[model samples]
Target chain A: MTLNRRAFIGTGAAMAAALAAPAVRASNHGKPRVIVIGGGAGGATAARYIAKDSKGEIDVTLIEPTRMYYTCFFSNLYIGGFRDLSSIGHSYGTLAQSGVNVAHDWATGVDREARTVTLAGGAVLPYDRLILSPGIDFVEDSVSGWDVSAQNKMPHAYKAGSQSELLKAQVEAMPEGGRFAMVAPPNPYRCPPGPYERISMVAHLLKEKNPTAKILLVDPKEKFSKQALFEEGWNRHYAGMIERIGPDFGGDNVSVNPDEMTVDIDGVVEKVDVCNVIPAQKAGRICEMAGITEGNWAPVIPHTMQSRVDENIHVLGDASNQGDMPKSGFSANSQAKVAAMAVRGALLGSNVFPAKFSNTCWSLIEENDGVKVGASYEATDEKIVSVSSFISQTGEDADLRKQTYEESIGWYSGIVSDMFG
Target chain B: MNWKHDRFWGVLATVAGVGLATPVVAEQQDARIGDAEAGKEVYDLCVGCHEVGPDAGNGIGPHLNGIFGRRAGSVEGFRYSKGLSREGRLGMDWTLETLDAYLENPKALVSDTRMSFDGLEDKADRDNVLAYLRQFSDSPQNIPESAPTGRAREVGLSQETLAIAGDPEFGEYLSNECTTCHRIDGTYDGIPGIVGWPEEDFVIAMHAYKRKIRPHPVMQMMAGRLSDEEIAALAAYFGDLE
Candidate 1:
């Protein structure tokens, strides 16, 4: 029905207005938006899984400071003079490919009531569901004389990267027969076996370069990760090179003198050429600010990885207090999946399935030798508890060790692919 | 007048037929229980731990060879908690009613029981497990002969089946991952070497990871990536090495 110019304009405007009305309604329709903070193992995996599985029903956004993450899992190999940092680093390009809106910014604060995450760049990203996996924060005040400035002299290579490099350099540059002291923090920390693993890697390096060098491990606890295996290996391979001090042997009590580069144990001040002070850690600052952290870690429901304090928010990875589960990359990744499912279910109004989680940590004693510990967990009440667990028995045969070493490598590739590709 | 009388007689006959059917339906409902033949199908989940054969050794829990007449904690070689042993000394035997109750709610029946199981919630499931338990006794009743086969063989292969198979190429790729908590040459604490260990032991260890019987969080996450076939291959590859 051809008509005059005024009549045609009026019809076109009416049709356009009708189309625009639905666009406005669509923005406020269907499922809720989920904003994930951090792009490490937990955060990245949650974002990818949620975005991909939501089938465009839920909006997902990931806020991370960096585009690439150098994993702390294999960072020790780099410190031990075996692998480079590039080999362990992963990028978030695959996450972007999964249709997650990756925002390159640090999450400064979260508005729990409003359900919005405030970024460092002053952007308030709104979310119906929020998942936080920002990892750990070191307790600077726990050490008597150690602060931010002292980190340069006595590096805590707990978080990997430059700190790991610094520690490696210190070990490399030490004089022959130099005393290397490692002050391990108390229990309930990230990577329960990490400090012990570091000692093994460092001892491996020392045996080749400085045979007479002394590696003194000052731990707060008497027994440590894979206690039997480490003792067997030390006595057999690094005889007289490593001395471990537990609480019974005056290792638990530590007073650091950062200015002097010295640590005192049981009133005995020992000056060292190299010192690695791993301070006590807590949930990342964001968790503390959100009031999710009870003491140093966030308490979460194991089945869903949902925050106990706020049901709308879910916490995962090293930041969470999942009892009996050590803070490791694998645990973080596993938790991310549980969190993803819960977030998806909550947003879509679907049934939340019970979550079963598994974690494995492989530590290299030397170049090819490896040992591991693993567990499976299920959520009970409000916390994750171990349903089953395994420790590699003492005196493993050569084939088992060799195969385990191989399995460890395969796991790394698989997990990195699963998390970030 | 003849047609109206015929329709009324037909309606009265239909009412009498429905009235007679109610009592027959009630009798059928009462006859469903005590069917041992039907109970065998419900007992599958229990056979993994409790075995009936003479050659069957302890598989984490005690053998059920004479469980019906035996006291709860009298089984030797199997560690029983003081609570269970004390209860055993008091002369506790497995009766049908007690067994039914215990099987229905193990933790409630015996608090702090180390069974690690939340009892069978379904009445039919509890009845079947009880029926299956009864088959192992000296007095065999009308138990079904068609119990599922291959359960014992499958239980034995649980660990072997769970290990990750080693591929040297994949192994080399995985070596970097192992360095986080394991050592190849030097040992510091309790971390073991992985260079030349037996594949069978490695496989068992990996199975432990999958089963969550191992206590480490790190290994649990790492083990989650492996498939059952991949675990076997990894185990075979590792077990074959020197």
Candidate 2:
């Protein structure tokens, strides 16, 4: 109540309100249609910002498969009980209210030459510019004995919602002293810190319900983002409960047997109570189908996010092969602003400033115990380069950790508002 | 002044009630007081870690509600770093000078702060951001000696007495140059929609470029050619847009 009261008397609208959602206009017949595929952080923000800033000058439509979009950013926190699934879920009502056409449909194909996106319903939506922010999709055959068919039993849970629920259920159902094995994905995956955060969360849940349970992380990469901080957290709270096998120790050579729920690390096979097999990932199917893939991801100019293959299309979030930025929701949100600005400028001729981007990734090791790594970036000719960066140090005091946790909470709220609204 | 403009004075009245009128220096700023409207844009740099609304809880940095002259590191529910706490105990109130210094380089000022921001380097940008923060300040603090004073009666009556006032009609007449770059209907070359902006913001931005506080050489060259009234007129015309 105090928070609401405080907000009521506070100065003008918050930054989220001030920046996007312009009051300009044009009729559909004359207005340029901007189609955004995906309703996650990147898509929603881009759609809202374009529509708002244009004030009806540019027509904007958002195509998403689901009406209730659950964010992948804090899904790990949900597994660890820091948040409920509903809290991380967002709807398109605000975007619709702000004058965006929110269409719930799968984008089946992009007729690049025709400049139209054909939806699953067979309706073709024309656009002056198309923004593809389809989040990552797991590489089908990247890991042996692991595929989408076995996802229900040995869940990847990367996309959030049902998969996340399944993984959390599996972690919860584990017996005391049981082995919970996680086959972490390789580099160029969505949310670089995500797998480790999931590990920390599962460890927290296990420590509470099954204290002696072991967390076995089979990591393909030799080093990970925030490695020191995560290592410190595991030592401090979940000490002796987690062990990581990096590439040097055959972490790269791993296979899963879903029927038996066993993970074979190199030549050694280990039976596990629960298995989370996160495979190598690539841009979503639609991105590949659209023919934007240079390989696993679409290439885009770092400044405008315009696809290198086609200037009319912009690829954002994990799907983009922009330099130096992680494929995280935070990064998506940051990139969306730049793309939105560029898109609007291209279509409506809105005043545009230089592209500026920032990202912060937070991981919760325990309740009220969190750490973060973040950076400020500028778009250079070669790539988006980091200008300044900071990371939480190992063994930080409780107050700082608590502060970091609180900050994550604040960032979550602010970013969600910036995206959904 | 119109009823819309009166709202600022009304908000200031509440602040002035508990406000301290300490003599201030524009030591870190220029002759012109920065505009809060433009400052909001610059605040984008700090948005990564700090939260700025009244509803904002402590983020990585403290929620900066009513931060001006608020005791350093004294926001309720926030855990201040040890170095920051010492600054508070040593009686460091968040004055314009303190804020300017902190924004210049947080590490140098606090030495042991746990904040992740590298700090905002430009002084003019800092002044603009501070102006933005001053709006939410529950109680007013310093009064810059250089700022307009004793113009209360004139403030609500004539544009001449207003600090950043402009005549929209005159601005419209002189807006030919703006048209080539910024189209009247909010459509132009990769340029943004300058229409419907607050006059104060437009003035501050032009001043930022004219003063070379910001980095755009083209903007600096263009802004350098204008007089204060001409800039104000242009702002008024553009502000009247949308």
By TM-score, the best candidate is 1
Model 1, position A87: C-alpha lDDT score = 87
Using Cα atoms, each model's DockQ against the true complex is 0.03, 0.02
User: For model 2, what is the error of residue A163's alpha carbon versus the real structure, in angstroms, after optimal superposition?
Assistant: 0.6
Error of 1 at B84 (Å): 16
lDDT of 2 at A228: 80
For A1-421, candidate 2 gives per-residue lDDT tens digits of 0011222222222211212223222234577788999999889989987988778988899999898989898999999988999999888899999899999999999998778899999998887789999998888878899999999989999999999999999889888789999999887788877898899999999988999889999988866777788898889889899999999999999988999989999989999999999999999888999998988889887757888788778999888988667788878888898798777656644433335566667788889998877654555433554433456777778987887787677567767766876
Count of clashing residue pairs in every prediction: 74, 15
List candidate 1 stretches off by more than 4 Å.
A1-31, B1-242
Using Cα atoms with residue i matched to residue i, what is each candidate's TM-score against the true structure?
Answer: 0.63, 0.62
lDDT (Cα, 0-100) at A170 in candidate 2: 87
lDDT of 2 by residue, B1-242 (tens): 23332343233222222232222211111112355677899989878878887577777778887676578889888888999999999999886678878888999889999977788877668867876775565311011111120011111312422332333433543453343235456642334557888989999999998788975433564565456766877887887778
